[model samples]
Target: MNNEAIDIILAEDEPALGMIVKESLETRGFKVRLCNDGAKAYKAFEESQPHALVLDVMMPELDGFSLAKKIRLENEQIPIIFLTAKSQTEDVLEGFDVGGNDYLKKPFSMEELIVRIKNLLNRQEVQKTAAIYAIGDYSFNFPKQRLTYKDDEEVKLTHRESHLLYHLLQKKNKVLDRSFVLKKLWGNDDFFSGRSMDVFVTRLRKKLAKDDRIEIINVRGYGYKLMVP
Candidate 1:
């Protein structure tokens, strides 16, 4: 809702349907770019890096799931909403499993789509808090999206990784409740998101492994504690 001309990449093969959705969003002050195939959509996404992505499940060259995986490697926090005709319990679960924020069945109302986009964007704004956090021998800057290793090497962290690190460091020396972390960082404690969080913790462990004095201790069924000696 800032009316700041949100950029979106619409990947739908049906020419007429694609135009309708594109125009509808554009009418509401969004900047929409349409791609007829998944390959082109990926290329467009790489070039534009839109605020949110609307992808069709079935497409040429590559499917929506494939395109999403590639996008997640480079950009982690950007909103991804799957717009597809495949409406099954498993399908929805699969979409979220692959890092999607939301999944919409085809024939969805424009109003519903708009609401989901707004929700995703608003959640993103909330998640963007303090950029720089002090960890052992490293400064984690979430906004710049970089991790400085104190002249050793500057490594970049994915958005989720950076945010997860910040949350843990903020609670340094105290036990960070796992459920609290899952809800705060990912906005959900669902199975897929929980697994995704585990992956992030593993990556963070590698990043912080250089410092012997710093440790991330799993508190059994509770959560984690970041300790500095």
Candidate 2:
């Protein structure tokens, strides 16, 4: 999205189709590494660590599903789209079961393939910056401003408390600069704003006291660090 080329690994046995797909993806600014067999693709994946994979179900050295399972063992988050001529229900189910994120039947349009790749990447990015986070034994839902401990009733947090907690969690175990947080939440790092942040931090400490492993420590001359084991 920011002119950074997306890298893709494509494993296809058909020479002609493989070349066409490679050229099409490159034309749209994707850096593609085309492998003629599943074995070669696996090797390429090890070396390149591409963002996503497009694999043909039937290959020379290994099959796509097997390759996907192997890759899953190494990395679970990479998006995989299986390309195959077979459209059986079991085949589709097997694809999902074997860690394939999406399945595309053969004779598919390049445009459709591109869309799926983009969509999967987008979904993955969203997951990386999810609103829900786990803090020791507590679950913090940023959107709802609720913190729940085990099976206990959820504690409703104020707007400032929720925002402050989110930033602290974002930099968990590291000192979050006081000035940066002040400007982020209150638009200024004045004396009153800093005092307000301290109050909110105190309130948060009380709420999170249920979890003994969690701590919000003030770093003398620096800021606060949310410590979670």
Candidate 3:
């Protein structure tokens, strides 16, 4: 077993180039799934659920932009890198709008590609460990989404509840931008989501009510504030 270091889906139609990239990454401890065409790449992606993507913009059956958009519809966090020959400003912007994390122009250095991938993975790890927070008498384990109270009670939180609490806690003593919270969690700040956010906030207030020192206040017309005294 080669330790499958970082799972990468490589979608390059050129057989020789694909082999070179795949061998290069594997030698460096990355587990790569090489698909010669876009359709096969998309299928492999769904089946293997790789950690990241290295997709060529021009491919048979489906282009990189379409594939990335499809994946983003299901997952917003997976890092996607577009390997393209087109370096037009509009092309780059379109890639970003379709949820690309980075773009590597054709004729790029393999070393640079490796570095970018590592940097993106590192950044994700950093974002994953936002910060453990202390609210009132509770210790929030953000990574595990667990809340421990009084050293004896560990409360597991639902995904929504946990993420909502994280955002609120991160802005302790200040207003949590309502729009930002909605966009980050729900992917939008539509009327329905805004209302739903209000409901979730109310639920959190009740959940943390055990500690009188902890309060989540609505800062009318702005956002909510988590106050820990």
Candidate 4:
């Protein structure tokens, strides 16, 4: 990954710390957008579609967890790092639960942050490289968000649908944990997210219904299995 081409949104309420972090990242060849509040950071995210995000947990208007949840609704792949003074186990778990890729405690080294960002971007690049999958008689091109059946019928998938299908394909023939999929795709395993996942599963089933060999089966208490025979 080229640091110069990477854009990062850094959301911190403290002006001094924000500038220090922004300047440090910029010095390392990253393009940094420094926003003082979570709301402004979100606006910057919507506008720039940055490569990654570094957010402070305590911010006005929208907290880091809330902002991350909102962003996950829009994009599941974008790397998000949360910075906070609170280092409790629950806080860290909450960060991940809200779709944060990494959690950094306050008084952290800039070098560590840079390394984490690069690592995430590299992983994302690898996923992009392996974007296509074959399921029974259907072909899924994740990057293009297109699913083709028998080389003729084509189904365009939304971002969520594409990700959901990708997860299912990864665990084909085996049960994919419902809670795991919900957390990965919807940022949380809440009631509404569960309902959303169910709806997407149905949509995917309908799209792949052309081929009877491909079936997304509910594992009852577990999750779903994409059985491709």
Candidate 5:
């Protein structure tokens, strides 16, 4: 892994622990900014635009779960690791349910955490095909969550929107099962998440409306189809 390519936002309420971890990562050539609370971490995330996040599940003001959910609203693909004392099966599941890519138990070895970070970053990089896709008159950069319309400026899509669009495009002219998508994304095939998915679909529709040839058709009571000419 290229350590130079990484920038991290770490949030831990314990000041001593946070500093130690920050210094250790910095020693290994990672640019890490440590914050003691979730709200400060979020602000740093917005300002620094870090490549990954290491957040404590229990934090002052926002807490890691809430912060992670907030971040997911705008960016779904960024890597997040929850470093906390909570280590129950349910706790780990809860971390992932909020869009975290990984979870580490408290009292973890900094070395182990480093390895996990590298592995997660490498894994995500491997997923990128580095190919721009054509959807109607728009060009999509899936890795960047970007869509370019020939007649106007580029549209930046939220993480959920981008992933939903990807599935639709891959299954073009075919049905993408509603429950399947909900389970894969929100970790549950329930009514509330289904409604949330619908909201995302509507947002995508509006964004892609410029291209008349691109149609996201909902297969009533089933799923959605991305019809491309």
Candidate 6:
């Protein structure tokens, strides 16, 4: 199956602009869901689990940063792209700090956004096939699909879940790209696979939750990081 159809959740307050971006991406063979507010974007994210998120910096109810933070808490490995009129360095830095993977200023070209998204997604795919990875307080067995902690019980993982975990584990403290994972594992980075990946991530998180020393940090626009402390 073709995995080229990467899904994206676009949160833009401007109606005309949102439509343009969504239509442009769809024309480029991407599946995009356009949202008007930060709150709705978050809801769509929870339900759709799009490969990547295009978030507007300012909005009513939640704003991009807050939504990103919330999304991070839920899933650490979803790619997020920020769209904003603010070009200040501090704002950009703050966005990065909040886990944004990429930022596009207002009046940005669709081509440019697409390029950045593709680049980020490509990086995510490379990490998935990594054979060796350290996750949290455990060593991730990629081929075996298991994470062995310092305890007697080792959790065995399913094929897709293991592949996803391996991808995140390889990233270590860095963000793993969302589209990269969906394309590599499910052969598509579309809406459905994105949702599936979320479920898998949830399972992985539950298994790893036993260790308080490790954290799976979610970078809003890029992906998740398996932080081993």
Scored by lDDT, the top model is 4
> Is 3 or 4 the stronger prediction by lDDT?
4
User: Per-residue lDDT for 1-229 in model 6, tens only?
Assistant: 1225798999989899999999998887898888899998989988976788889999988999899889977765566788999876567656755767666778889998887788657745654555655665677766555778874678876445666676776677788888898666544576655665666677778889878877777678676777777
How many residue pairs clash in each candidate at the backbone level? 0, 0, 0, 0, 0, 9
lDDT of 4 by residue, 96-172 (tens): 65777677788999998898788768757766787578888899988666899888888877556777888888888
Score candidate 3 by TM-score against the native.
Answer: 0.57
Model 5 CA deviation exceeding 4 Å by range: 1-35, 39-51, 54-77, 81-123
lDDT of model 4 at residue 210?
86
Candidate 3, residues 18-109, lDDT tens digits: the string is 99999999988889999998899889978987888999999989999999889877776677888999976567657765777677788988
- Looking at candidate 1, the ten consecutive residues that score lowest on lDDT are 88-97
How much does candidate 2 score in TM-score?
0.58
**Could you say which candidate leads in TM-score?**
1
Give lDDT: candidate 1, residue 107: 89
- Pairs that clash in candidate 5: none
lDDT tens digits, residue span 1-229, model 5: 5898799999999988999999999998999988999999999988878889999999999999999999988777788988988766556656765877766777888888898788667746844765778988998888887899984679987555677788888899999999888766554677756766787788889999998888889999999999998
RMSD of 1: 5.0
lDDT of 2: 0.84
Question: How many residue pairs of model 5 clash at the backbone?
Answer: 0
Candidate 2: tens digits of C-alpha lDDT, residues 25-138: 998889999999999999999998799999999998999999998998887678899999987656765776587767778798999899888876875675467678899999
What is the TM-score (0 to 1) of candidate 5?
0.58
Which residue pairs does candidate 2 place in steric collision?
none
What candidate 4 gets wrong by more than 4 Å, as runs, is 131-229
